[model samples]
Target: MISLEQKHHSLLQEAKRRTQPDIANLRLCFELLALTAAIDRDCAVRLAPHNLSEGKFVVLFLLHGQPHGLSPHELADRAGVTRPTITGLLDGLERDGFLARHSNLQDRRKVSIRLSEKGDATARTLFADHTQWIGTLFGGFSSEERIQFSALLQRVWRNTDAGKMASPAIAGET
Candidate 1:
């Protein structure tokens, strides 16, 4: 595994060699990418035992909170995936009896996605475990440190114009 120090050293060298403008900002972005990758891996590890993937878990988590269900387009927007990709994710969940697809009476072409009874229970169980895992993961940080870290991350998100651009579909996200 590449440690943060090694990553920083490599990025610093690249920046110096290229004489990159905004070296400090570039370095900060690299570090943040590394940190994000680490967190994503951890989340995946925690979700795997529950037979959940990051994408699936995110979909279910969103569905769990909305009893009325969400349209596929809405799920695509909220889950940060393309519409076809959302279909595949929802397909497996539905096949396993974790979700349901409802056609709009007014427009048969329109469909809403919802968690089924089994899916809801399964997701709830996984969520409890995942929540505990997250708590443990961040346990090293004191309350103040956690606050500061969250603030820093939020600032980075704002600085990066995260989701500020048009929808990923419009942006040609695949």
Candidate 2:
């Protein structure tokens, strides 16, 4: 039986030999990454005037969704980042008066991070403008196409996870 590494190498060679490297698959990956970067950069640019970074904006946005707040670990899990990274982002947000950390009443040892009024306002303003861009990006797809695309992407995610092809969290990000 051929080794997995050998099979992978063969597949790589086959991919390279293709005329356009499987247009649909290649374009899917390229477009997803490009779009993510573009969105991130645009958000960063908008946040810059307020002295906020992309990561910080993301943290604020996530927290804004759950006004009740989330623990650092929970926030990290939702944000697809390390706890330490979330910690730094939260630190910046807190320092800027965008959020506050409160000890969980049930578990004093656990800390919950909540957005301040300023953070709420910022999140609303940013997302309100961002939604226009999001709508434009997906406007070309019909409703049925959007549904089908989402289903197909979910199947791909499940297959990748079941096969242990990549981190499930990372797959979900795509």
Candidate 3:
């Protein structure tokens, strides 16, 4: 079986033969996607022992410190997910005793989610370790290199905004 790097090189060579485009930019995009997949896999492995999906972890991390808690809609918005998705995550988290839902004092119909004691403890422990894990991912970089990389990544991120996307005709050209 071919390695990923070998496959990537083969794909790039085929692309170069078929199109008159910036092969270097296309290679960078491919590399970025591979990096993202690797990072995601690493995250899943790290969270597995704690029985937390990234979505569940996001909800718990968001609700960690606030005694007042946030509404389901608020969590969906903060998590950048749809209402149904957040509801599913909330269901699992609540079922597992990671969170509790309380009705609002004035509006009994409205519900807010708060971290349970177990959830709080888990979040605290995960936060510390997670921070270190994330930092370690960048440990190979010097401070200045990290700063420059962050700036470059921010520039790339800005271009990824939906409103900034090129139209289909132009996008298809390259």
Q: Cα lDDT for residue 158, model 1?
A: 49
Query: Residues 34-76, candidate 3, lDDT per residue (tens digit)?
Result: 7877888899899889889999999989998989899999999
Output the number of the TM-score-best candidate: 3
lDDT of the candidates, in the order given: 0.81, 0.78, 0.86
lDDT of 1 by residue, 82-104 (tens): 98999898987888788999898
* TM-score of model 2 vs. true structure: 0.62
TM-score of each: 0.68, 0.62, 0.82
Ranking by lDDT: 3, 1, 2
Residue by residue across 40-108, what tens digits does model 2's lDDT show?
777778779988887887887898878689999999998999989998999889999999999977989
lDDT, residue 103, candidate 1: 92
lDDT-better candidate, 2 vs 3:
3
Clashing pairs in 3: none
Instruction: List residue ranges in candidate 3 displaced over 4 A.
Output: 1-10, 19-21, 158-174
| Of candidates 3 and 1, the better by lDDT | 3
lDDT of 2: 0.78
